[model samples]
Target: MKKLLILVLMLAAAFLIYRFAFKKKRAPREKPVPVAVSEQSAGFNQSMNSILSSYYRMTEGFVNWDTAAVGSAATGLETALKQLNVEELKKDTTIYQTALYPLELAKTNTATIAAGRDWTERRHALNDLSDNIRTLLLTIKYDQAPVYWQECPMAFGEGESGDWLSSKAEIINPYLGNKDPKYGKSMLNCGENKMTIDFTKRDSARLK
Candidate 1:
């Protein structure tokens, strides 16, 4: 009876050890929650749209070689850019930091363009401004409208290149501008469409 009792005690200890130590433990499964678009995001989108509108006008001014129009459009673009909520963006640290550089660059260049400088200087500034805006748009994935990235190969000279954004696929070369004093067409159809930003598709994927 004593031996049988000892055997039963050992078996119980082994079972307990197996159950506690050698058992396959289950990990807690994580469920993905959908991110609902907030009012703040919508507001941000509206602000970006306003900026884009001004930018489009500026680009058109350049295409027409209207210095007064370009300067006015640049001022408007600068104002719209200033109205953007940097604090709101800072809530997402990574994105905020990533976007800061381009935002600043665009703002600065817009101001420079608005200063009523010579065409060469303004064109250079516009080039930088366009590039920075492109970077910002791609990084933030602004959902207002589809932006077409267009590049002009002979923008600055024969070999140099520049890029600009447009709401439509059609290319109106802001770099070439008017050929003659009468605002005649120059290299108006100069560039090609490189990319298009459509955030709706990305948002749809996230919904799934």
Candidate 2:
């Protein structure tokens, strides 16, 4: 009777141990969902492509002295503008209002070599637009910029066609004494420009 009681108590303890200690733990947590690249984003991307294509065609026409080609490309610009969801963009951000001015000007103008010269004027408008677009894309991907900036290398050189894409590449490795990197906070071209960002090193890029 004593042996049977001891055996029963041991079994009960084993059952309790199995129920409490051997139970499965929860799976690890998942990362947060990124913003979707939805139909709207796709449409915006298409419009941007159309605009850039038309601009290129218009410039090519001017270079070749083809007035008809320039006119066709100008018409293409109008089509691209029509595809743009101006009202939707305006609702989301004030950036559209700023971009619309130059776009309107470009649309109404006659095709001429002089029209090509208006690029600088148009660019001021478009640069703001581009900045907004980049911000939107980044927001979609990361929800926000990372708390920590990652370091990567980029190449330093002008384009093959001698376009002044970059005046020069100033690489300030924080590990070294050099300060004030030119590409500042951008991640897009770090590797292309052959400059390594040193996150491990002391930061010297801040303005003194």
Candidate 3:
């Protein structure tokens, strides 16, 4: 009976060691990462995004020197500009009135691009459009992402230069264009970053 009792105790100990100490462990479940989104800014951001999308397409057209593509994209950009959430600008009385001017100017520039007589005319209009768009963004306190303001020293001529806005800092000279038979791709990357416009909420400290 004593031997049997000791045998039973040893078996129970072995079972406990296998179940509690040496048992295969199950892998832990992973937690999902939370996505941050602001509903208040969604509409304004979307509207601005649409405008930039069309604007970038227009820039691409200019870079390729495709007149038809530029005209089409210019029309698209004008339409996008019209759909801007101007009401958002009304939140700040100071900028509310100031914002409309640049918006109108941008639209006008787009229209000019659409009806431009030649590549030179359209390119000039695009440069004006870029300036107006940048002003509008500054007036509206754009907070989505940084916009790179770039300048090409000899874009128009040896003594004339032009500025443009881009999402990336990398220079892609729309005025020079890759389609230039002589320069080919030599002048495509000719430009310097003038400034970076970033008004994200995290950068609110800058306003102070």
- Worst 10-residue lDDT window for candidate 2 reads 159-168
Q: Each candidate's root-mean-square deviation in Å?
A: 11.4, 13.7, 5.1
- lDDT, candidate 1, 96-162, per-residue tens: 8998999999999999999955887888898899889999887787766689989999788889998
TM-scores for candidates 1 onward, in order: 0.75, 0.36, 0.77
lDDT of 2 by residue, 1-208 (tens): 9999999999999999998999888898875544333324556656655665665565345334455765687678667756766555565455555656655554444223225454333323322332333333333222211112212232223321111011125322211111114443342333223222211222233322
User: Which candidate ranks first by lDDT, i.e. highest?
Assistant: 3
Q: List the residue pairs that clash in candidate 1.
A: none
Each candidate's clash count: 0, 12, 0
Which model, 2 or 3, shows the larger TM-score?
A: 3
Cα distance off (Å), candidate 1, residue 14: 77
Worst 10 residues of 1 by lDDT: 199-208
User: Candidate 2, after superposition: displacement of residue 5 in Å?
Assistant: 3.8
Kindly report which residue stretches of model 1 are placed more than 4 angstroms away from their true locations once superposed: 1-40, 180-184, 202-208
Residue 101 lDDT in model 1? 94
